[model samples]
Target: MDATFPRARKNQLGYKTSEVEEFLQRARRAYDGRPLPDDAPLDSERIRLTAFGMQKGGYSTAHVDAAMERLEDAFAFQERQIASRLHGDEAWLSEARTTAQVVANRLARPEGQRFDRVSRLALGYNVREVDRFADRLTRYFRDGWPIAIDDVRGVVFSAQRGGYRESQVDLVLDAVVDVMLAVR
Candidate 1:
């Protein structure tokens, strides 16, 4: 798989290895329990450890493997979807910024022509792009909390619903923020 999606910016999640490691840690913890121990060699190694853990009990290795596989698949799918959405939003935002700059440049033109075509185009572009970004951010705030690097939404939701420690909410929120800032 391509390491970087959307843009090659350092802040973008797919482009940053550290955050990806953190995501895998969170996901593994969500799948099993507790963040993958610090001792684990790496994120990929830790995931392998979790998969290894599935075999410890003599129950059904096949079933355990299947469950782990499902969790991994779900995490990848959700991450990609979220990243793609953020990428689209960032692209639009950049376009809006460019449009604004162009209009500002044109403002230096003779005063009579100041309110002409370029100004209108810039205003329209700003409204469209800004509205899109605002809408997307609102949606993100509404939906972002539940999705985490660890694919632990179920755990977070159930814990919150059952009134466990509220910190889990913070953890999820932080992870979401990481994804947002990192992906953008």
Candidate 2:
């Protein structure tokens, strides 16, 4: 199809062009309040979790990722506006605060114990790395420390045997993102 983003360098693989185009089109329709064929409507959370296959000479990964982030933020803002209108502003704020509190409580746990650990034989996120990131997240929530949404969205940790369970940590991160987006 048409060029939606720059191609990855000659031989490097990037997101498949058709997949990216299709997703973008669907997002546009969703944003415009048009009906989608699927039962699960597109939203910011779906955007956050969206993935595309990779192929040689496809759309640039960095560019598409940046676009997706922007798109997610826009959808989140629109959702917030709608919710605030449906409920009172205080109600919306209260819900956001509740989610923030839940996330904060989880992060408040002592380092390395904030999330469950996997079996000793299984690999998971590095304990030290995750704990350090948790400290930063705690500061962001409790101390009002400035943090970019992208920082939380893009954080990565090394893997180790018997480290924190990936799914649990990921769920917490998703919750954190929800709080951030709600308050934004």
Candidate 3:
């Protein structure tokens, strides 16, 4: 019940303290191999997608986000260990490689055409920004360029009418994260 994270500045909004605390408790339990009743066991993917409501005085967003990244890494490591143990290292690695290949193929598409666009009147992620990010991802996978998981996780694109479809771009980014975590 003690404050799990520092509050935001007096006037700035941050994640709702109660929600963050509850989710952290659940994550902790899951990390310790004790999932709550009727709740699906937590995993790295779930942790990556977790969000909290905001309030005027609540847990600092940066602090909570850093904690989430660490938690996600821990869970990913645990999952990798378990999978390797059950399926053998070769199989586990093969799966990761396959996933990487799939992501690579998506990124291989030409710029501006990599993902579907929204309807003319609708808004989506900026095509140019996404293409630029995708270029970085391609280098990371193909040329051994260094790119942090946070870089991929924190990327934000401007919205444009008839821009690249948001869901499609998001899914690709998620897959890229999965591939990175699997090999890490």
Per-residue CA lDDT of model 3 for 54-141, tens digit only, reads 9998889999999999999999999999999999888878988998999899999989899999998999999999999999999999
**Residues 1-184, model 2: lDDT tens digits:** 5698999977999999999999998899899999577836999999999999999999999999999999999999999999988997889889989989999999999887899999999999999999999999999999999998889999999999999999999989988998899887
Candidate 2 local Cα displacement, residue 107, angstroms: 0.8
lDDT by residue for model 1 (67-104), tens: 44455455544545555687865664454455434433
Between candidates 1 and 2, the lDDT winner: 2
TM-score per prediction, in order, is 0.24, 0.95, 0.95
Off by over 4 Å in 2: none
Q: What ranking of all candidate models by lDDT puts the best one first?
A: 2, 3, 1
* lDDT scores of the candidates, listed in order: 0.38, 0.92, 0.92
Model 3: weakest 10-residue lDDT segment is: 33-42
Give the runs in model 1 whose Cα sits over 4 Å from its true position: 1-50, 53-57, 89-184
Q: Number of backbone collisions per candidate, in order? A: 2, 0, 0
Candidate 1 vs 2: which has more TM-score: 2
lDDT of 3: 0.92
